[model samples]
Target: MRLMPRSLFGRLLAVATLATLAALLLASVAIGHVLERFVMRGFDDRLDAQTMVLARAVDARGRFDTTRAIDLPGFDEAGSGWIWQVRSADGQVWRNGAEALPVPASRADAPPPPPPGMASERARDRDRSHPGEGRDRTGQRQHFRTLTLMRVGGPVAITASGPRRVVEAPLREAMLPLLGSLALLGIGLAAATLVQLRIGLRPLRTLQAALGNVIAGRQHHVPTDLPVELAPLAHELNTLIDQNAEGLAHARRHVANLAHGLKTPLAGLGLELADRDPDGRLAAMLADIDRRVSHHLRRARAAMPGAPGRGAIPLAPAIGDLVDVLRRVHADRPIAVDVAVDGVTVGVDAQDLDEMLGNLLDNAWRYAATAIGIAAVVDAGKAVITIDDDGPGLDANQRAEALVPGRRLDEAGPGHGFGLPITQELAELNGGGLVLGSSPTLGGLRATLTLPL
Candidate 1:
C-alpha cells in the first residue's frame, strides 16, 4: 500500500524514472506542436495561393468559374490534394473534393490592410482571418487548412481547402523515431543518475568501515581519513573519549590524595601513643586511634586502580582469604570461620573483591561470641557474598544502624567502624553494593555483598 520505496536505491531509481518520463512526455508534446505548426503553415500557404489565383481570375465583371479549373504545375485536378469553392458573377457556387468548405471573410487589420488592388500582397492578409476554417468537427479528424479571398467590388469569392495530410501524415509518421530517441535518452539519464547516487554516497561507505574497525577493537579512535563533511564528526568523537579518560584519571587522583592525607597523620598518632602509658587514658585513646587508623587504612588499601576495570575476580579464593585472616585475628577463642564458594566470579578489581569480603569477615569476628562464617558464590548473573556471626543479632533499629559507618553493637558502640563503610564503598566503586540482613548460619547479623559480573 505504501507508494514510496523502503530502500534508497529503489527510491532513487523511481525518482529518476519519474523525471525522465515527464521530460520525455513534455518533449514529445512540444516537438509534436512545432512539427504540426510547421506543416500547417506550409499547407495554409498553398491554400492561400490557390484562393488568390481563383480570386484574380474574376475580373471587374465578377465572372469566375472553377468547374474546368485553372491549370498550374503541382496543382493538377487529379491529385493536387487541394479543394476549392467559387461563387461566380451569376451567384452560382461550386464546391470541390473536401468534406467541408471554409467561408471567406476579411478581418479588419489593426495595422492596416494590404494595398486595395494588389493580389500578391493581399492574399496573405486575407488568410489570417480564417485560421480554424478547414478543421473538421469529428473527434478523429485529420489536419487541414483553408484560405478565403474576396474580389474588390464583386459578389465573387474563392475559398480553398487541403487535407493537411501532407503535413500531418508525416507528423504521425515521425512518432516512432521520436519515441525511440526519447526512450534512449531516458535510459542514458537513468544510468547517469545511478552513477551520481553512488558517487555521492561514497563517503558514507568509508565512514561505515571506520566505525566497524572501532567496534571490532582494531582502532581506538574513529579514522581521520575522511571527506570534509565527516571530518568534524570524527574530531568531536575523539575529543569526547579523551575528555572521559581525563575525568576518570582526575577522580582517581583525588581519591588517592584523600586517603594519603589521612593515613600519614594516623601513623604519627599511633607511634606517639604506644610510647606513652598503659592502664590510663592513653591506653583507651590508643585503642581508638588503632580503630580509626585501621578503618581509614582499610579503605585506602582497598581502593582499586585508576585504570578502567577489565577482568573479574573469582569469589571463592577471595572469600577464603578473608576467612583465613579472620580465623587468625580471632584465634584467642574457639571462633570457627567457614567459607563456601561455587567458582563464580564478579567483574571487579582484585583488591575490591578482597576489601568487600574483608569488611564482612572483620565485622563477624568482632561481634561473634562463638562462631564466624563466610560464604560466596555467583547466582542469577551476579556474585553474592555473606558473612555471619553467633553474637546476639541486631534488632530492627540496630540492624539499620549497623549498616551505617561507625554504628556498632558493642557497649562502647562501634566508632571508627570502617568495616561496613569500606565494604559498601568498595562494592559501589566496583559497580556493586552491600546489603544488611539476619544470618541463618551464625544466628546473628549478616552482611552481604552482591556484584555484577
Candidate 2:
C-alpha cells in the first residue's frame, strides 16, 4: 500500500531515477525521428538523380531514345529491385530493368510531376517522393521508394525507384550505437545522483550525533555551526535544555530551605526532652522526625541534575575506600571481606556512588557472621555490583518490606529504616536500581546494584 519510501534518502533517490529515465526516453524518441528523416531524404535523393539521367534520354515528341541514357548499376540487371521507367502519352513504355513498374489506374490520378529544371527543388518536399507497392517479374509483390519526373514540353513521365530497404537498413544500423550511448548516459546520471544525495544529507547525520552527546551527558548543548536550514532547530533544543536545568535547580533550593528550617526545631526539641522524658517515647519520635528530614534533603540533592559533560567514575577505588572505613567502624567484630571489583566504571557521580555502596556494605557488615563477599561485572551495558553476607537472610516477603521507606523489620538494629530506601532513591536518580535477594554463595542477604556504564 505504501508507494513512497519512509526514509528521506530513499524518496529522493526514487524521484531522481524516475526523472532521469523519462528524460532519456523522450530524447530517444526525438533523436530517432530526426535520424529516420535524414536517412530517408538521402535515399530519395539518389533515386531523383537516376530519374534525371533517364529523363535526358527522352525527346520532345514523346519518344525515349534508349542509347542516350547512361548505364547504372542495378538498373539494367534482371530481378534487381531498382527500376526506372519512361511512359509516353501514346502507350509506348521503356524500362531499364526486366521488372515492369506498376502503372497507376489513370494518368490523371497521379501526382503532378515536378516542373523542368526543378528536380533538386522537388527533392526537398517529402510529399512528392513516396513509397509504392509493385510486382517483380516472378509475380511477388515488392516495396519501393519511387520518384517521378516529367519533360516540360512533352507527355513523357520518367520515374526511378529502389527497394524500401535502402531507406530502412541504414536507420537500423545507426540505432545500435545511439541506443548504447544513451544507456551509458543514464548510468552516469544515476551514479552522480547517488553521490549528490550523500553529500547533501551529511549535515543531518552530524546533527544527530550532537543530540546524542547531549543525552549521554557528554555535552551541554548542540553545536550551532550547521547549515542555515538546521540552525534554528539546534538553537531551539539548547533553549529547552537550559529551561529544564533552571527549573530543577529552583526546586532543589526550595527543598533544601524547607529541610533546614525543620531540622533546627527538631534538634532543639531533642535536647529539651532529654531530662523531662525518662521513658524516651518523645525522644524516639523526635529522632524519627530528624531522620525523615535528612532523608528528604539527601533525596533532593540526588534529584538535582549532575554536572554537565561529566564522565564515568572508576568503581574499584570508591569500593576500596568505603570498605576500609567500614572495617575501622566495626573493628571490634571479626569479619572477612573479599573484593573482586577491578577495571569497572559506572556513569554516576562519585558522591552518589559512595552513598549507595556505603549503605549496602554497612548492612552487610552488621548482619555478616564471619565473611562478606563483594564483586562487580558488566552485564548488558550496565555495571552489576553484588554484596553478600554469611548471616541470617530475610525471606522474599521480608526483603520486599525492607525496601519500603521508614518500615523497619528488625527492632534490635540501630536504624530508623531510612538507609535502604535512601540508597534505592539515589540509585534510581542516577539511572540505576537496587534489588535484594538471598545470596547463593554466602547464604545470606545479597544486594545487587545496577548502574549505566
Candidate 3:
C-alpha cells in the first residue's frame, strides 16, 4: 500500500526514475508536435506549388485555358482524393477530375493569399463530405489540406488540395524512427540516472559502514574524511562518541572511588565487630553489606560502555585457562573437567570474558559431584558456551530465583550468592545473555552463555 520508499537510497532512486519518465514524456510530446508541424508545412508547400501551376493556366482577363493546364499525377485522375479549382470573376468554375473541389463563393470570401513569392493560404477540411466526389472507397468523408491563391492581375482564385493522408503518411513514417530514438534515449537516461544515484550515494554507504564499525567496537570514531556534505555529520558523531566515553569514564571512576571508600570503613567495622561479638552475627552482617556494595559497584562498571577497538577474544584460550584454574581450586573433589571448544572468538573484552567464565566455572566446580563439561559453538553469529555440572541441579523455579542477587538455594555452600548475578550482568553488558537450565549431558545444571562473535 505504500507509494514511496523508506530508505534514503530507495527514495532517491524512486524520485530520479519518476523525474526521468516525466522529462521523457514531455520531450516526446514537444518533439512530436514539432515533427508534425514540419511535415504539415512540407505538405502545404507541395499544395502551394500545385496552386501556382494551375493559376498559370488562367490569363489576365480571368479566362481558363484547359489545353495549357498540365496533368499532374493524382490530380486529373477520378476519385484520386486530389483536386484543384479555378474561379473567374465572371463566376465561371474550372476543375480537374470528377470531384467537385469545395471553394469560397467569391475571391473576397476566400482565405487571404500568402506573402509575395511564398506559398498560399492553407486550411484543413476535416469532416465535410462532398457527395460522391470527396468520399473514400468505403464512403467515409475524406479529409484534405488545401492551399488557395489569388492571382495579382486578375479577380481569379485557384485552390489546390490533397488527401489528409498525403501529409499524415510521411509524418507517421518519420515518427516511427523518432519514437524509436526517443525510446532509446529514455532508456539511456534511466540508466544514467541509476548510475548517478549509485555514485552520488556512495558516501552514505561508506558512512553507514563506518558507523557499523564503531558500533561493533572495531573503530573508536567515525571517519571525518568524507565528502563535504557528510564530513560535518561524521565530525559531529565523533564528537558525541568522545563526549559519551569521557562521561562514562568519569562515572565509573566516581563509582569505584565510592566503593573503595566504603570498603575501608566496612573492614574497620568488621575488625571492631570481631572483638565485641563472639557469635559473629554482626561481622556476618557487615560482610554481607560489603559484598552487596562490591556487587553493585561491579554491576555498575559492567553496565557502563565498553572501550572501543576491543577485538574478538579467542574462546578456546579463555575457556582453557578458566577450566585449569577451576580444576586446581576444586582439587579436593575428584572432579573430571572436559572442555570441547572451537577456534571461535567472541566480541567481548578478555578480562570481562574471563570474569564471566570464571564465575560460571567456579559455581559449577562447587556444585559438581564427579564431572564437569564445558563446550562452545558458533551459532547465528554468536558464540554459545555451556558449562555443565554433574551435581544436584535446581528445579525450574529455583533456577529462575538463583539468577537474583543474594539468592542462594543451599545455605551450606560457601558463597555470597553474587556469582551468577555478576556473570549474567556481564554477559548482557557485552551484548550477550546467560541462561540456566538442567544439564542434558551431566544431569545437573547447564549454564549457557551466548556472546556476540
Clashes (N, CA, C under 3 Å) per candidate: 0, 0, 0
Any residue pairs clashing in model 2, and if so which?
none
Ranking by lDDT: 2, 3, 1
Models ranked on TM-score: 3, 2, 1
Better of 1 and 3 by TM-score: 3
**Model 3: per-residue lDDT, tens digit, 125-208?**
211112111444445443333333344443566667667677678878888898899889888987887888889998989989
Q: Against the correct fold, how does model 3 do in TM-score?
A: 0.65
What lDDT tens digits, residue by residue, belong to model 1 across residues 1-453? 999999777798788789888988999999989888887877777766666666666665665655446645344564454556666535777655543453322332112334656777666755443444333434233333333444555345566655555776788888779888888988889889889889877777877777677644457687767778888988887788678657865775575576567667767776777767665687677667555545544444444445354476777777767767766866776686666776777777665666667667776777789777767766766677777888877777876776677665575735476677777877776656788878886689888788877
Top candidate (lDDT):
2
Top TM-score prediction, candidate number: 3
* Stretches of model 1 off by over 4 angstroms after superposition: 1-21, 52-56, 71-82, 88-91, 97-129, 133-144, 164-168, 212-217, 255-453
**What does each candidate score in C-alpha RMSD?**
12.0, 9.5, 8.9
The candidate, 2 or 3, that scores higher on TM-score is: 3
Candidate 2 RMSD computed on C-alpha atoms after optimal superposition onto the true structure: 9.5
Clashes of 3: 0
Query: What does the lDDT come to for candidate 2?
Result: 0.80
What is the C-alpha local distance difference test score of candidate 3? 0.76
Error of 1 at 194 (Å): 2.2
* Model 2 Cα lDDT, one tens digit per residue, 331-398: 98879999998999897766678879999999999999999999999997889999999989999999
